[model samples]
Target: MEALRAEHLDKRYGADETEVWALRDIGLVLRAGEIVALLGPSGAGKSTLIKVLGLVTRADHGDLWMNGERVLDDGAPVADVGELRRSHLGFVFQKANLIPFLSARQNVEIACEIGERFAPRARADELLDYLGVGHRGDALPNTLSGGEQQRVAIARALANAPSLILADEPTAALDKERGRAVMELFRRVAHEQGTAVRVVTHDHR
Candidate 1:
């Protein structure tokens, strides 16, 4: 199934003399059960593309569809962006970004709650277990190893069973081994759970 599609996307910053076209005529399609890596150097508009596709930033011009529904048109939103995001999209960043005070399970639980899933706590635990982080569920983020923290973040991202996940430099902070593991984890999640994943990174390996 097509999880996401965007065509003729354009994004610009500033006006007149200082104007910069961050992205122009960019197009993309993502299907379920696929893991796509957006590899580029710095200032290549990779993150801009992610932000646009994730709906965190509007494209100056484009048409965007998710799950066969048209959500954006000509830089404007046709649907409730917030509701669509909560229901269909997940995100991971360079850092784990888990709340400091919340335990691993609670971090995932809050996401489940936001996604309005039933039995949030149970769902959180299930995801943690599925991601191989159940044993660390009660541990704080700071206490967990880097790889473990990233696993928890991935579990939280899966809490809503989202159709698409957008990860921006998700492994940039990890060591080589842990980074590869996280990339492999994304592949597993995409294939096994039928989620579409887009990861932005400088790593070409």
Candidate 2:
């Protein structure tokens, strides 16, 4: 099934004279259990596209379908955007934005609790183990390496068992090897969990 589809997405900034168009009639389709990479240089609207897909930034004009449901049409969003996002979409960014006071496990636990489905502790542990970061569950974010932190972040993103995952520059902080590992992790998550994954990146390799 189609996980997400965006049609005629347009995002602009500034006035008519100094208008900066970030996304111009952009369209994309992602299917369940598929992993797709969006590669572009700086200022190429990669981030803009991610923001639009993730529902952080509204497109000036477009239609959005999530899991076959119309969530956006003609630049208008559904009534409960927050609920829709929290329940169906997961996002990872360039930095591992973990809560400083929360341990790796706690970080993931909070997300599960918010989702209000499975037991937070058990689900958190399961996700950490799935992401290969179970051993670091009790450790604080500060104690983990860049790669480890990113792994924890991924675990947290998966806490809700979302149907779609959007990552923007998720590997920008890691070394080539670690970055490749994370990319592979996304692929595995998509195929194994039946989640659709879209990653925005500048790494040409």
Candidate 3:
């Protein structure tokens, strides 16, 4: 089954004379349990695409289906976007962005808890353990290594038990080895949890 899919997506800034198009007629279908990377050169709409997929930015024209439900049509919100992003989607960014004062476990739990209260603690622990960061659960974000912090970010993204996970330049902050480790962790999550993973990256390697 397709966890997330888009058709004829477009995003634009301004109108008429000064119009600038960030994305034009983009479409993608991602099946659950699939790990796919979004690759393109700079200014190729990667950010625009991710923003559209993540429900942070609206498309000028398009349709979106998340886990087979239509949430967008012609770039407009079909349903409540706040609910859509909160319940059905997970995201990881370039930096781990874990709260510095929060423990690894707390950081994970808070993200999941903010929208949905159920299973927050359990989900946090499960993801941390799965990502091999359970041992560092109580450590503050600043206390963990860069790779470990990134792992915690991955775990946090999984804390919601989402059907789809979207990552933008997630590995850009890590070294070569750590970057691979982050990507592999995403793959494992997609396979084991039956979640669809879309990673937006500029790393050609």
Candidate 4:
């Protein structure tokens, strides 16, 4: 089944003269249990596309169907983006951005607690264990390594069991080995959790 489907998506900024086309008639379909990476140079609208698809930002034109529902249509909003983002989508950025005071498990559990997801801390520890970070459940973000921090971030993204996971430059901060590990973890989560993963990166490296 397709987890996300975007059709003829177009987005622009500013008025006619100063307008900039961020995305132009872009179309994409992501199947369940698939891990796809988006590669492009700076100013290529990669981040813009992720934001629109993730429902963090609205698309100026086109439609986005998540799990077969029309959330966005013809540059207009049809559903509550905030609610949709919370219930059906997950996101990760360049940094882990964990709460300084919160431990690993707490950081992961916080998302599930706020969202409608059933599991909270239990799910967090489970995911952290699966991601190979269970040993650091009580460790603060400052105490964890870079890889561990990203792993915690990934676990947090999966806390809600979202059908679609969108990440922006997720592995940018890690070295080659750690970066590949993070990418592979995304694949594992997509396949194991039956979620669709879409990542935006400047380089496949």
Candidate 5:
């Protein structure tokens, strides 16, 4: 099933002499159970594409569809963006960005609460276990290793069973081995859970 589709996406910053086109005529399709890596150097608009597809930023012009439903047209939202995001979208970032005061499990549980899932605590525990971080669920973010932190982040992203996940440089802070492990985790999550994933990275490996 098609998880997301974007056509003729154009994004520009500023105007006139200082105008910069962040994205121009970009098109993309992501299917359920598929993982796509977007590679580019800094300033290549890779993050811009992610922001657009994730619905965090509006394109100057384009159409967007999620799960075969039209969500945006010509840079305008046709649906309730917040509802769509809460129901179908998930995001991970370079920093684990877990709440400093919350345990790994609480971090995930909070996301479940936001999505209005039943039994947030159980769902959080289940996702942590699935992500191989069950043992660390009670640990605070600062006490966890970088890799473990990312694992918790991933679990939080999956709390609501989103159809699509957007990750931006999720492993940039980790060593090669840890980075590869996180990437592999994403692939596993995509295949096993039938979630579409798009990862932005500078690494070509």
Candidate 6:
């Protein structure tokens, strides 16, 4: 089934004179249990496209459907964007962006509390364990290494059991080995959990 679909997406910045067309007539379709990577050059609109699809930014012209529901139509907003994001989408940024004062477990636990129905802490631990960061659950974000921190972030993203996962430059900061590991983690999560994953990155791997 289609997890996400965007058609004829167009985005521009600035007025006519200094205008920049970040994306033009772009289209994307993702299916459940799929892993896809978006690659482009610095000015290739990769980030802009991800933001548009992730609903962080609106597209100038397009239609978007998620899980067979029309969410965006010709720049119009969908039903409660925040609510839809919380219930159906998961996002990971270049940084882990975990709350500094919270432990890895707590970081994920808070996300679980937002849109989940089960015991938050239990679900958080389960996710952390599943992501191979179970032992670091009690450690603060600062205490963990880059890869470990990203693992915690992934666990947090998975806490809500979102149908689609959007990651922007998720492995940019890590070394080649750690970056590959993180990419592999995304692949595993998509196939094993039946979630569609889209990653925007410059890395060819």
Among all candidates shown, the one with the greatest TM-score: 5
RMSD of each: 0.9, 0.9, 1.4, 1.2, 0.8, 0.9
- lDDT of model 1 at residue 58? 86
Tell me how far the alpha carbon of residue 135 in candidate 1 is from the true structure, in angstroms, after superposition: 0.3
Report the CA-based lDDT of candidate 2 relative to the real structure. 0.92
Tens-digit lDDT track for model 5 on 106-154? 9999999999965898999899999899999899999999999999999
Q: Clash number for every model? A: 0, 0, 0, 0, 0, 0
Superposition TM-score, candidate 6 onto the true structure: 0.97
lDDT per residue as tens, model 2, 7-75: 999999888899999999998899999999999999999999988888899889999999999988888
lDDT of 4 by residue, 1-205 (tens): 8899999998898988999999999999999999999999999999999998988777878988888888887868888878888888889999999999999999989998989566787888898999999999999999999999999999899888899999999999999999999998998998888999999999667
Candidate 6, residues 54-138: lDDT per residue as tens digits? 8899889988999999999887876678887898889898999999999999999999889865588899989998989999999
Point out the worst 10-residue segment of candidate 4 by lDDT.
116-125
Query: What lDDT is reached at residue 185 by model 3?
Result: 88
Candidate 6: lDDT of 162? 91
Pairs in clash, predicted candidate 4: none
Which sections of candidate 5 miss by over 4 Å?
none
Most lDDT-accurate candidate: 5
Per-residue C-alpha lDDT of model 3 across residues 15-101, encoded as one tens digit per residue: 899888988888889999998998988888888788889999878899999988998988788888898788778889998899989
Residue 98: error of model 4 in Å?
0.8
The 0-to-1 C-alpha lDDT of every candidate, in the order given, reads 0.92, 0.92, 0.87, 0.91, 0.93, 0.91
Candidate 6 ranges beyond 4 A from true positions: none
Please state the error at residue 147 of candidate 5 in Å: 0.4
Worst 10 residues of 1 by lDDT: 112-121
TM-score (C-alpha, index-matched) for candidate 4: 0.96
Task: Supply the TM-score for candidate 1.
Answer: 0.98
Residue 166 of model 2: what lDDT? 96
